[model samples]
Target: MNFSIARRRMVERQVQGQGVKDPRVIEAMLQIPRHLFVEEAFQSQAYGDFSLPIGDRQTISQPSTVGVMTEALLLQGGERVLEIGTGSGYQAAILSRIAGKVYTLERIALLARRARRVIDSLGCVNVNIRVTDGTQGWDEEAPFDAIIVTAGAPSVPDQYRDQLAIGGRLVIPVGNRGDQVLMRITKVAEGQFTEERLIDCRFVPLIGRHGWQEGES
Candidate 1:
């Protein structure tokens, strides 16, 4: 399969057709080789519009979803960004092209290590990956300009709200296993938040403390 051709189709039919108009976001999605982030068996489907399972039962999000979420960030060239559920590190890689600094967390140790290696090999100096429960929200790097939760949670964790800088935005998926809604929450002021629903989505449950507990796994 010629993955590059499929990738271009994704950009034109899936991403751009779906309203992901940010030129930078589109360019990042187009430039990054999504196949490198997935298993060899799934390389042919790398740029398809559907999510592909990676490992540990986690899946990389669809390209269209990634593009829309990135465009929603409204990055101003140098924004500190936090990403939860760094599956395959694909989304984080896309963010590195636009954000100033990206801190991504993963619950699974093996996936985190592999993602770190791939990200570093690509020479993305601005991205940092850690093997930790993402629900905690990287306290040392609190007050990020933007936060993105790649997995679905029953509700937005309070810790994530605390980590946001005033005027910052968090894009997260909220709901149960089979159904979820993508929501954007802006930190309007200290202790005040404004929310807008972006779209409906289906995502794996976010696993960790302050999220779905380990026992649930």
Candidate 2:
């Protein structure tokens, strides 16, 4: 199974085909061997256009969705990024390619450990993974140039908004339990942001403080 060919095709067909025009994003999607991020049994489907389960009931986001969400960040390189919900760490990997550094958070211990191993194996030294609640944001690393939230939340978390550097972008999925709209919020000034809704999508709930309760459906 030659993953490079599959990755190219996946980018041309599923990602680029969706009008994701960032060259950096396309290159990152091509460079990352997405198959390694999944279990060996599911590696063959890693480049597929649809999402796949990665364990602990979380799903590795589909290629197009990842592309879309990432492209929305408008990363210009050499920026510190905060990623909530690292999942398989695939998103963080992409972020690492386009940003100077990436800090990702995963609440589930098992997922966080597995993702760390995979990220380390890929030699993505720019990515830093932490096991903890995501909605709190990383205050010590306050004012990120960009933030990407992988989970769907009922509403945007206030902490996320507060942690953005001026003119930084926060890309997130917000709405209900089963559906969400991708939103790009740019912090133009202190306590001021402008939002643009991108597309309709679905993702697992963001479980943490300032987000959905752990047991909520």
Candidate 3:
């Protein structure tokens, strides 16, 4: 498969056509070899603008969603970012290209280890992946410039809001199973958050402290 051509079409059609206008986001999407992030069996499907299962019942997000969410972050170079799900490390890779440092957390230990290898193979030194309950956020590294959650949560956890530095932006999918809304929460001031719904999406439930429990699926 001609991955370059497929990625261009994905950006021109699935992403830009859907209102993802951030030039930096588009450039990162076009430059990253998404095929390298998924398993060999699914490499051909990498740029198809659809999610591909990675393992442990998780998946790499669709290309358009990744573009939209990254654009929503309003990332400027040199900002600190926290990613809630590191499935495949694809999204984190994209962010690494735009942000100075990316601290990503994955709930599944196996996924974290595999993604770490994949990320390292790509030489994405700006990204750091850890296995932990993301619902708690990375408190030790709190006050991040931006926080992005790749999974769906029943509601925005208070810890995520607390971790956001004033003026920080958080992009997350929130709601119940089978139905969810992508939301951008902006921290305007201390203890004050402004929420805006961006789009409807379906994602694996965010699991861990303050998140959905196992068997809730």
| Cα RMSDs, all models | 1.2, 0.8, 0.9
Off by over 4 Å in 2: none
Clashes of each: 0, 0, 0
| 1-217: candidate 1 lDDT, tens digit per residue | 8878888898999999899898899898888889999999999888888999989999999888999899887787789999999989999999999999999999899999889888888888999998898999999998999999999998899999999999999999999877799999999999999999999999999987788865574
Q: Over the full model, what C-alpha lDDT does candidate 3 score relative to the true structure?
A: 0.92
TM-score of each: 0.96, 0.98, 0.97
Q: Tell me the tens digit of each residue's lDDT in model 2 across 1-217.
A: 8888999999999999999999999999998888988999999999999999999999999999999999999998889999999999999998888899999999998998898898888788999888899989999988899999999999998999999999999999999889999999999999999999999999999999888997887
lDDT for 37 in candidate 1 is 95
lDDT of 3 by residue, 64-136 (tens): 9999999999997889999999999999999988999999999889988888888888788999887888889
- Candidate topping lDDT: 2
Error of 3 at 13 (Å): 1.3
List the candidates ranked by lDDT, beginning with the highest.
2, 3, 1
For residue 148, give model 3's deviation from the true position in Å. 0.4
Give the candidate number with the greatest TM-score: 2
Error of 2 at 17 (Å): 0.4
